[model samples]
Each structure stands twice: as C-alpha cells, then as structure tokens.
Target: MVRTPQPGTHSSTDHDPDTPQYEAGAGGWGSLRGVARIFAEARSSPEALRILAGQNKPKGMMCTSCAWAKPAKPHTFEFCENGAKATLWELDQRRADAEFWQSHTLSELRRLHDHDLEKAGRLTDPLRYDPESDRYLPVSWDEAYDEIGRELRALDPTEAVFYSCGHAGLEAAFLFALFARAMGHQNLPQSSNMCHETTSVNLLKYLGSPVGTCTLEDFDHCDAIFFFGQNTGSSSPRFLHVLKDVVDRGGRIVTFNPLRERGLVEFVDPQNLSQMATGRSTPISEEYYQVRPGGDVAVMAGLMKCVLAAEDAGPGTVLDHDFIATETTGYAEAEAAVRAMDWADIEHHSGLTREMIEQAGRIYLSSNRVIGIYGMGLTQHVNGWLNLGMLCNLLLMRGNVGKLGAGVSPVRGHSNVQGQRTVGVGEKSAHMPADKLRELFGIEPPTDDGLNAVHACEALLEGRMKALVTLGGNLVRALPDRTRMEAAWPRLRLTVNIATKPNRSHLVPGQVAYLLPCLGRTDRDVQETGAQAVSMEDSLSNIYGSIGPAKPPGDNVRSEVAIVAGIAKATLPRNPNLRWDDWTADYGRIRDLIAEMFPDDFADFNARMFQPGGFYRGNSARDRVWKTESGRAEFTTPTTLTALGETPDGQDVMTLITLRSNDQFNTTIYGFSDRLRGLEGDRDILLINRDEMSRLGLDEGQPVSLVCAIDDGHERRVDDLKVTPYDIPAGCVGGYYPELNPLVPLGYHERNSQTPAYRGTPVRVVP
Candidate 1:
C-alpha cells in the first residue's frame, strides 16, 4: 500500500538544532548507554544496584516497567534499561523532606516541568497542602487520615471518587477497591480506564474474558504472528527476544503501523551474545503495512473479506467448517457482511491496496498456528471496542481460540493492571457477582457501573464529585486537557493521594490535599505478620510473588495496603465486623479472602503461589468454553472506516497521533533524551512525512504550533514544537503524549470503552 507524496520541503529554518541524533538499531550499544544514563543520574546508589539485580528473579520484585511476564526460570539479569531507569527514579538518594517543600513554594513548583519534579526525589513524609501558606507541610498520619475521613464521610458517597493506579500490587488494588465500595461509592476510576481498558470491557462482551488467552510459551509453537500497533523493542525490551526466536524458527511477522518502528525493522537482542557481540540485528517484520492511524478496522475487515472470497472460490479453502458448525455462531451473517464489503472504500480509508491485505490473508489461510497481538495503538481510537471485536471474529474463523499456539493477545501496559481487574479494582460488582459479593463480604456493593477516567474528570468539573482519593498515579498529568483538569481539580472539596514520590498532582491541590507517601514495589513492608510479599498478575495471567528489598521510605510513611486500610477503617466506624486490622496484619489473609470470593479462578490461591511460575487465572475463552451470549464464539462486524473529520473552508488538517518517547514511561519522564528516536534535549519535536512537511512549507527544526482543528469549545494548543521529517504516513503526524495531551479533548474518547482516542485527531499545524 503506497500513497504518492509531494516533493520534500526545505527552508532556511531547516538548520539543524542541537538535538542529539539517534541512529538505526535499537539495542547493542544504545541499550548499554541507557543503563549508563540511569547510573549517571542516580549516582549508582548501592540500594538501587542491589534492588535492580534482584529484578524479575524467581523470588524477586516484579518489574513495573511493563506487564510482560517472566519465564518459569528467569535469567540472572532480567532487568531492562527502562526498569533500571524506573528503579533509579524510585530509589533516588535525595529526599523530598519537609525542608525541601518548605523552600519551594507551590507557585515555584508549578513552574517546574513534571520531569524535574520527579527527579527531585522520593516523598519522605505525609504532606498536607496548606492553602493559607500556599505551601506543603508535614502532617501526622493520624491527622491526615482523620481530615480525609471526615471529608469522605461528610460528602454524599456518590459525590466521592476513587482513582486506582494498577502498578501497585494486587493486594493494594483489592483493598482500595473494597474500601471505596464499603464507603458506598461505586465511582472508582482507575489507570485501566485510560490504558488497555478496551481489552477488559470489550473482550468480556465477546470472548467472555478480558485477558489474553495465550500463554507466553505459545511463542515457541506459533508459526506466524501479526502485530498491530505494538513496538516491543522500546516498550517491552525483554519481548524482543521472543520476536527474534520466532524469526529464527522461520515464523513470519507482519506489522500494521503508521510508521516503521526501528524495533520492527531490525533488533539486536541484548540478551543474545552472538548478536550483541557482532553488532548484528535480526530483521523482524517480513511484510510491514503502513495502515492509516484509525484504519485498523478496515485493514482487518479487508483481510476477512479476502478470506471469505477464497472460501467462496473453493469451499473449505480458507475457513474451518467443523469448528464453525459446533463451536461458533454468527458465521453466516458475518460472512455475508464481509462478502458485501466494498474493496474500494477499504483501500481508500486504510491507505492500503487490495494486494497488501490479500497477502496477509494468504498467510493466515496457510498458517495452522497463528497469533494476533495488538496494543493501545488499536484500542486508543473511537472504534477501540469494535477493533477488538473484529480481531476476535478473525480468530474465531480459524477455531484459533483453544488451539495450541493460536489465540488473541492484547498486550497490557501496567505490571498488574490485569490482576487489579481480576481482584476487583473496578466497581465492586467486578470483584464479586452480586450474590458472591454478598456471600463473601456480607454486604451488597453498588450494582451500577462507575465513571471511568474521562467521566470522573467530568464529574469533578461539574461538582458532581466533591472528594478525590488516588491510590497512586498523577491523574491530572495523565488525563487530557490539563488546562481544564487543573481548573476542575479545585472544585473538589478534598483530595488524597498515596504515592511513592511527589508528582505534579500533589502540588496542584484541591481545597484540602494530602500526599500520603507509600512504599514502592522495591520497598519492604514489615507488617504484623512479619515481612510480607505481594502478588501481581502479568500480561499472560501468571500471578507471581513480588518481594521488595529496600526498607520503607520513612518511619511515618505506610504501606499502600495500610494507608488504604487506615483510611477505610477510620471512615467506617459503624462496620465493626470488617477486619481492616487483621487484613493489614497478614496479607495472606487477604489472599484467602480472594480465593473464597473467586473460588474457580483463585482456588488454592495461597498454596498455588508457592509454585515456580505461580498460577493462571482461568479464562473461558482459552478453553473454548463459551460463556458468551450465543454459547459460542460470536462473530462481530466492524464499522466502515470514516474519513478524517471535516475542517472549515480553506483549512488543511492532518491526522495526529500521540505516542510515548523512548525516554518516557507513561506520564513519568526520565529525561529529555529519546535515543530510540535519535532525539534529545527536547520532546516537543513533531514527526511529519517529508512530503507533507514541504506541502505545509515546514522544514526540519522549524518552530511550529499545533491547534485542534475541530470546532470543540475547548481551545487546545501546544506551542513552540519543532517539525522533524520522518518515515510516517502521508496525511499523518506524530508527537509525544502528556506534552501534547493538552490538544486532546476529554469528550473525544471511544464511546464504548471510554478510552481516550489518542490518534486520528485532526489538527492544524502552523509554521
């Protein structure tokens, strides 16, 4: 698939900036330099080194950098560069003590970039934002909890909101979810509401589960793998090993993305000595299609159409009939829809010729073992739900669900976000079915669905939510429309955040703000039960033990579990039967309760965790045991790809997609350097196709401003961005998120999943 481009543009402003240039090849020396950068910034503290060495070990802390699970026997040094950076950032020697906060005014802190604030070091004590002084001061844990409890109890329960960060252990997530429910509030928002939430809500609707059905071991047997929107090299460094092994086994890898991620083109497995020693990188994607930003549906649908056409030309040529007859439904209708789909529209919207999709179809028809893997790129769109549904339909056609090496895989981002969902981090009903929750907790939790990240922001703005309590995460920086979110936050009467380090959220206060410092994943928790270990579920549903080595940050700081428990116990004095103290004393008790609540999934939860790789939460989709509406894997028809939203007369708009840089992880910025992209010093660089840049009369390093082209009431603009020519699609441009998040409107999100559509945003680029 190819689109003709205009001539390359050049102007006097094209003079090269002082930005550090990156080169091809993702690993080898680049990976080593990343580790060196971590050491240089953190001064290579002993605790950081010791803690990092134990990362991803059999009985060590789970790496929070990515949710990708480890093998049964982890290697000696399994930590990736990003994990090292995260460790250095978390285990910083400098402390955000009372003295630091005393010297820095809230106004001064607000002026500092989010990255500088993170590098200032860990929050060493509980801090309360004193509105009168416009500064934060240390507050006793009891006083902070009491003030928060009073506000929570006084407000109408429905007017309070709880935001969860799934990077925390499952125990913390479970306790927070329970605490919110016990307080009679179901409007609990979570990190999953923004990131891979479509995988949870949509997979449940069609496949009967939200988690990936395939195990990591499936990589050994799969013959062909298709990747959509996942750049494993930078996001999940360890996963590059899997891709290389697949290629070595003669397995084909096809990628569908707007730009050619260097990882997908060639990768040097840092773990592989021969490749790293000789500076040899393996070619990954055999056929790469630059599908339009919002055109995943059209591409997949066109492939499905090709499959149906082949089936029509020769019966039993492409599809599995026996599996369809007994194991699935909706085949006849879905087939008819695909047969009638217009190829011209598919090619137009997808920016791919029919030949490209047919080649993918032929690979699918021939391969007996195939796995389709996708990431937020597909789900962070208006059609996120349908995108997943269409992938399910494609997998079901081949009876791939319960097969040896074939199933659906939506690679999640956070370490235990999946487990957080499994342990009931969403609305209370998600924890236990109505009867089960009543039977287990002896209290009926709210039955109604709660607001996601987007809706929760809306509630805060509209004065529908008065109190905000976050388990962790900088929700304001993570959310869209910071100018508006910063304004909306003050509408809330109370705000409480439990975090490992101080972020911009703590500084941007509500009327009463409490920053309750908590232990990091690499910090030890000494409870009444002696030392404790928390469990986390990874991308493949493997629940493993994560034990931290470093001691708690300070004498006053509490474990996330304890902090959450303390607040809940203080607020609910009426519920005498609830044993918050007992749960805090022994986390194993909480596991027992979890097992009791989810008998089939968590049977022998405590005992099975003793095994090397922990246990797998059961998925009906994996076993082909249909819990879906039709008693079979139902087929879903995807909608036609719509053209970019119309602009005003004489307006030239380009589709914009916000992505993460190599130096960043989610909202946290390690530094300005993005070595993977050959960028440094500045993150405001906008990636544009060479032809498109010239058409707009823009040149490399040319200063530009971006404004939302839509006629939305929200006036979003990010200024002083430099344009960089890159190998992206013709009508598309790219910029890093959190920096460009201001351009995204809260209302512009996937309707079904409520996941903010970070791509396909129409924008006017001013030079």
Candidate 2:
C-alpha cells in the first residue's frame, strides 16, 4: 500500500544517557579531535600534512567533502572538522593492492560495512569480478578498457546507463555526459537526481534558472536568515562562520527543522582562541521551531498566509506590491491559494500554532533583507518539488530575490556536484541543455528522454537496462531500495566503476564488474601539459581551479579525465569527431570546448580559472532576469498540502527521517563515531522523542523493529534497533542511512523532481 501524504505521520528523534550531547558548539576543540583522528588514519605522514596545508587555500586543493565556497581570506586552519577527515581519507596511505584483494574474497568482504570497505584503502589496480572464486582479481587497464569497449559496442546505447558522483572532476564529468550524448543516449544521471533535484526543478520552473540567486556575500548583508530543514553546521561546517557573522552583526536567524541541530542552537569558532579557551559559545538561531518531518511545504504556506493576511489589512503591508507587479506572474492565483488554506489545516500540517506562524511572519515582515536556506531535509520528500516552489513563492512575495542578503538558497552537498550538472549531467527529460551539446560536439544527441537513478533502478530490475558505467559514486549503495536494488544488480550485463576507494558496490557482482581506480581530488592530476589543475563550481556558482600537492595513492591509479577518455577513445569509432584524445591531453582544450558550449558563462574559462578563486558563473535570476516560460518569476498555487503520512496501525507509526552521521559524508564513512551528535561505536541505534516514548509505552534502549508502513507492496524491515531518547520533534523517529534506506520505496518520490523521500518515510515501530 503506497501511503498518501497526510497528517497522521510525525517525525521524531532520540538520545542516550551514556553519550553526552555535543553542546560545546561547532569547531573549536571538536576540530582538533577530527584532526587527531585524521592523523591517526594517515599515520601522521608528511604527504598528509602537505595535503592538509593546501586545503581551502587560494591555490590549495578543494575539500572533496562539501561545496561550501572558500572565504576571501585564509585562516591558519581553513579546513573544518569534516574537511580534515576527507583530506586524510583521500590521502590515506593504506593500499588495497593486488595482495590485499588476493587475501579477501567477495563473500568475506560483503560482510563488512560500507565504511570498512572504504577503510580497505585505495584500489591499486583495475579489478575484474570472478564469480567462481567470488573475488575481484586484478586486471590491467588495457584489458579493462578493451572489455568495456566491446561490451559498450555490443549493447544499444539506450540499454546502458552512465552514473556519476559529484567529486568527478569537471573535465571528466563533461566527457562523461558527452560520452552518453555522443553514444546517442540520455541515460546520464548524477548525484543531484537523488538529492537536490527539487531545488533545481522548482527554481527552474519559477525563475528559469535552477542555480542559487544569491552569493555568500549576501550572508554578510542579510538582516535576517530563515532556515528550513537545514543544519548548516554539521553538513557544511564552513557556513557556520557565516551564520555566526550574521549574529555578530545583530542579524536574527529563524530555524524550522524537526531535530534541534547543535549549530542552529550555538556555535564556538575554532579560530577564536580566547572563546575556545573560555568555553563560551555564540548562539545562532534567534527563534527555533521544531516543525514535523515533511512539513516544510505547510510551514511555507503558513508563512505566506500570514504575509497575505497582513497584506489584506494594508494593501502593501507585507507583500512587495511594486516588485510583485513588476517581476512575478500568477500572483493572484497563488494569493487565493494561500487565502483558501484553513488556519486549522495549516496548524495541523505545519505542526506549529497560529501564533508561532504569525510570529515568524512578523520577523519576515520586519526584515529589510532576508535569506531562505534549506537542504535535503526539505527536498527529499514526496512533494519536495512543491516544497521548493512554495519557498520560492514565499521569498518572491517579500521581493527577496535579486537583492543583497535575500534569496532562495539550496545548500547542495558534495564539492563539484553542481559543476557536474552545469556541465550537462542529467536525464534528457529535463535540466540538461542539449542544444549546446549538439552545437559544440557537432553530433546528434539523443532526442528521447532517459532514466534517472530511481527510473534506472526500475529499468535494470525490469530487464530494460542491461549495463551500468559509473564515474565516481557507489551507485548501488547511494540509491534507494536496497532490497530491490540488490536484486537489480545481477540483472545488469556489465558494470564498471571508475573509483578511488573500493566500496560495497564493487562487491555486488555483475556478469562483468570492473573497478578502475582513479586519482582522488587530493592527488595532483598531471597530464601532457605538465602538472594540471581541475576546475570546480562551488555551491555559490563560483568556478575555481583546484590543484592538489600529493601524489596518486597507487602507480596504477589514473586521472579521471584519462580513464573517461580512455574508455571513450576505445569504445567509439576510430578517430571519432568528438576527439577524446585532444581533451584528455590538455584539459585547457576541454575548457575551450566547455566555453564553446556555455559561451555566456564559461567564456575565457581556462584563463579566468587561472585566477586564485574563480569567478561566479553568473545567474540571470540575480538581476531579476527571469528565464522562465512567462518571462517573469512564476508562482505555483498548489491545491492542498502534501497528504503524506501514516497512522498508528496497532503499533505506533513514526515518520522516519534518515540522516548521515557526522562521521559520514554521503556514503563515505570515516569512523563509527558521530561526535557532533553524541553518537559513537554504532550506527544501528534509532532516535525517538522522549515524550513520544512515554506516550507510546516505549522506553530508552527498548529494542524494536522498524517496518515500512507504506508497503509499496514490498517487505522492508530492519529489526532490533535500540531506541534512544533524543531532542527532536515529537512523533518522529530518526535513524542513520544507508542503514534505513531499504525503508524508502522507489515509487516514493516527488513527481516534479523525482528525488526519493528520504526525509519523510513512514515506518511503524513494533515490539
């Protein structure tokens, strides 16, 4: 039974008595602990120190962890806690050489968790899966490419899928998407499809462009910052300083999230020695509202409704009438929709009292310059697309767009994920600017739309998709529906992973599974043009060059560009028109091609990137230039809030929001401890509200089974999870992912964006 979005479902959290909470704010001593862990992992190697010194500097390596833009000035320690871990993890001296692989069998390795697999260290060579022995044996690059080319040529392009993670270098991702396009297939789906796809989808629908309208500079000028379902501190630690600066300048922040994130409550600057020494912390959020899971759309509605009510009292009281009339469309319809929403329904859906909603509205009304910030918490929902659309509507109502300290901001994860999308990685259904590809490549791109992650999973399971080639991500591990995706893996005829560290995905055998290890972001990527650099686009759309100081983890490790080009050069017709060799030889030539493709944005791409921090790619929305269909910012008038909820069925049903541990980034885990969250040693614990525990006849440390309530006609269950009392919204339960990913259904995604509802999954806890 696929459940409809409704009110009975509620999100919750939990905590344990033994593990003391991380109340000492972000950074400070916490970062020192992270550095210590990294030092231990790298064994205090000089190469590790060199990589650390180069991190986040003007000419330093990009932190492969998050997409937070670099600050104008470099502090003595520029990297954050997680950034330290990522740096050390990338520079890890451990090697899973041929000897290591020879010692471990697939059956034995499969027992290890995802983190253990990564801890096995960098793959030393290309590995081919041998089913008879059930182990991945070493294979030469030439043999791997030859086999991949033969397989690619044999299969119809439509039957194959190209998947990439955010960390793949710009040139590599460009060639990756181009390879798909040139092969006459639109089956290229990257990380965004499963995470921030809603941000792009709704932003594109409203403002013509999907990129953020404001830069980090706006953080300095904003009078007030409104947070919706985002914990900037743990996710993007660099942004914590921006929040602190906002408060230091007398700016107020309002947060709406189910869980009470430490960063939103208070923060201690790691750089401020006095404060660090004194143990004093700076409080961040002026007001915090524990909204229910999946309630972002309703909260936005309530806020807009309050704005409209104030508008009704005085024609232009809260609404920016001048800006509304001049810069937006469908205002009347959207206004009516807001007016039509009942106050009781708003209260019910938003999990907030009318007074609270009005209070938040008053703050918005008083602010001269306001900013809205959100993350996967808002976007990974059944109605995530509407959630973003409503956010855009709320911001536009106050004329928040195109001004200092005011805009709709989606804090994307991964360093270069946005760059991957910018370089045209997407299903042909939308997002990809295909005309540019045809014009630049002089090849006919596939006209028909292709499959995204979820759709591709279905295609693979249903025998429609036969082959899979991934550039950087652990596709099987990163995606939803572990039960089905596990089943879908064997259905593929061939699977190729261009990676650095081996993961569980490699162990999931295909008829032909090949692991081609590539140089990581921490490694210096040298090509025929001497030591080379790769360009990355930050969350703020800042395009910059990143050059690392360390050598490749293994001699067999190749550059991403080389691997991508090698596969393409071997697979395609002899001397194809696209010329894979030229781009592979000189990345500058690749930039030249990109400049030709995205002339307005990437013009003089190579020369501009030579500068310390690259320039902004420029968003038309920033200048009130709407690229939308109506030539103005469009407004969507949704009829009702999402009906996504589940009722207690004999057993109490809780809205389960799966989150990453502080020790993890995406699927990469540094260790078991989540120091920021007071969690350690294990990832199997469930977080439930203390008050809700009492109401539901549950207690701290009580073991229970989590069963997917929205059956989707599938059996998804994780048994014997010990519940911990946590500081979160009542009626919601929390668990770490991808442990809880099996609870999420493939069909459970926003219609507009197709982002899996990881934040609003319905599950019942049974004794």
Task: State the lDDT of candidate 1 residue by residue for 1-767, as single tens digits.
Answer: 11223311111112123323345567777887888887788665677777877788767888877888778776667778777777777777777888888898999998888888987877888989888888889989899888888889898888888888877887888788877777776777788888798888788778777778889778889989988888776788777777888999899888888766767777877777898788888988888888777778878888888778787899886688999899888888877777778887787777777877888888888888889999888888777877787788888887778788889988787777888888878764655466766676667677777777898888878879888899889898889777899888877788898998878888878888888888888888899979988889888888888888886667877898899999998887566557899999999998888887778878888887746666778678888887877777778765455422333433367778898877888899888877776767888889886767778898888999998776777788899999987767676789998888888778777767778878767778987
lDDT of 2: 0.82
lDDT per prediction? 0.79, 0.82
Error of 2 at 703 (Å): 2.1
For model 1, the superposed segments whose C-alpha errors exceed 4 Å read 1-22, 642-651
lDDT of 1 at 704: 94
